[model samples]
Target: MTRDGAGLRVGDRPYRVFGCNTYYLMAWAADPNLRRHVDEVLDTAVQFGLNTVRTWAFNDGEDQWNALQPRPGEHDERVLEALDYVVWQAGRRGLRLILALVNHWDDYGGRRRYAAWSSTAKRADDFYRDAACRRCYRHHARTLVERTNSYTGRVYRDDPTILAWELGNEPRCARDPSGLTLQYWLEEMSAHLKELDPNHLVGTGLEGFWGKWREGRYNPPRWLGGQGSDFLWNHQPDTIDLMSFHVYPDHWHMDEKATMRWIREHLDAAAELGKPAVMGEFGKRGPRALRERCFRKWLDATTSAATDTEHPAAAGALFWALYHDDYPDYDRFGVYRRHESTVDLLRSYTAR
Candidate 1:
């Protein structure tokens, strides 16, 4: 395990991280094609030195509206089935999977209106409000967590393949969740996870852009502090034992010097809280040359302590992907072609 200066200890590490941002779980529709690809991806990841994986547990609709009573947070069989296989596969290959419980897509796809939390207060208004959502939470949230806490909804909770339980993906998305509603939901969800999955750590997948206009602190944008100063930092979401961050080129592109400098700025921000934060999702999706250039630049800068302008805050780094995209759109972002590549320069630094 490696613990960067972030003060958060990454279990089972040699200081640097080697992982892949994956979507195999998303495509699993209880089909053989999906299962085959899942094994292929995991095997490839292991051979390429990948030690960790950041994968999602369920989609918004994995267990959506039930025509029946729908009591509390009952998940459909699809979620349980998919997770069982995912955990089993990861465990077999020695890969740790960090499962994100909720995400913004489809029903909760950061859309203007998507109600995952409902209320049953004396008044409709009260029930519709966040307070009401909080009130009815335990019944719904606990059911969802309890089902997944076990190896199978059909079995018991004793899987050693899980790395952490994340409350949601980028709960800070203003487009989908209102600040207050999302914050309250996150607090409730995090607390719910702690009770359900105490065996593993918990966190939220957050994107790093500390000095943004959305926050109330720093008009001129000097620095930040405390919980209320920023997005993820603003709310001390429950069950968050570790932190994850995402980064990409700006609107267009940034050179090596600019990219490394910006990384430093964010690392400095995370360092103050003295919490371990992983660069969970980061990479340039363009021509192969551009991608290679960026990775080489980042790797060179990170491997050498001199390039880090601030404290060594980031614990591990995982590229955006490791699979081959069949379509033209996917090719631009995929780090490998149909056959995949061991030349994934980022994987070279997993031993860090």
Candidate 2:
């Protein structure tokens, strides 16, 4: 995939990212009994006309489930093979993937784990500036990019199935309200990833916060000056090929109108920057009717933007998540195959 003007294209043909997030694919694929869940979700994606999927590619620390990197610079071959399986299977189904390299939170031993492994720093935010932590991150990234998929026999860097590599999941540095720390880190890491694999795109997995430098009245009160990221500044790095932001109106205390504004703000920014933007994650929790209403509104806003011939609109939007019957709806945001109404809504949107 490549960017042309404000939109994305594949070998001269236009491409839009209508997709869903399946963050647990790697873990489930590692378990023989649970691997079917991965297949089930992807099959559903195809059935719905969805073409892209976002998932976590990192699992650090020894205690984490299916920890891909149980130790710094070391990995469990079995788990890595499982990841390879995910890449192979997704490609087989003609689906593109956006793989996040790390997490900002500690759920899968993210920044906090890296900080612990490399220094005495107790705050997860310290991972951004620590030299040792940066080294470990680069190492892990190199391993993944250079990895030769056991199933496909193709190095990850050379694989066309990968749409992009996300820097981290919603990266932030609350300790530095100016957002310079996180900004610099993103610039450095994105440049490094590009040096390693110039064939693929790199993105900052940010939540679309406005930093002190770029704050405006359009921003939500909670993000008046950002949690520690400048959406525009963070994407200034030349190596950063794609712009990404996530939305959770319920969690952010935003109503439907505010949510649409937030998305439009990012799409406008992406157009100014000459890059394609994606609503990497978005969802609401409540009764089915309420969820459907919000989803329809949000999808309408994004899809409408895609039709703008004068300016580049959002490349596409992906819902909060996709899950199968085998898994519990742990987050309430999970959209299962049995939810025919919701499935139909997403399917219709993708078809558009």
The clash count of every prediction, one per candidate, is 9, 0
Stretches off by above 4 angstroms in model 2 are: 223-226
Model 2, residue pairs in steric clash:
none
CA deviation > 4 Å runs, candidate 1: 1-16, 62-72, 105-145, 148-158, 173-185, 211-232, 235-238, 250-257, 300-312, 324-331, 337-344
Shift in Å, residue 104, candidate 2? 0.7
Best by TM-score: 2
Distance (Å) between predicted and true CA of 182, model 1?
4.6
Model 2 residue 242 lDDT score: 80
Clashing pairs in 1: 1-12, 1-13, 15-352, 16-352, 73-140, 105-109, 150-157, 151-156, 227-234
| Candidates' C-alpha lDDT | 0.54, 0.88
Whole-model alpha-carbon lDDT for candidate 1: 0.54
Clashes of 2: 0
TM-score of each: 0.73, 0.97
lDDT of 1 by residue, 123-242 (tens): 222322345444444444354445543343332234556666666555443332234444555566677767775766666676543434455432122322212224445335545666
* Model 2 global lDDT (CA atoms, 0 to 1): 0.88
Worst 10 contiguous positions by lDDT, candidate 1: 219-228
Q: Give a tens-digit lDDT track for model 2, residues 1-352.
A: 8877668889978899999999989998999998888888899989878999999999999999999999988999999999999999999999999999999988999999999897566778999999888989999999999999999999999999999999999898989988889988998999999999998888888888887667463667765475788778888788888888888877778887798889889888988888888899998899988999988988888887777888866888888888877778888998888888998898888768
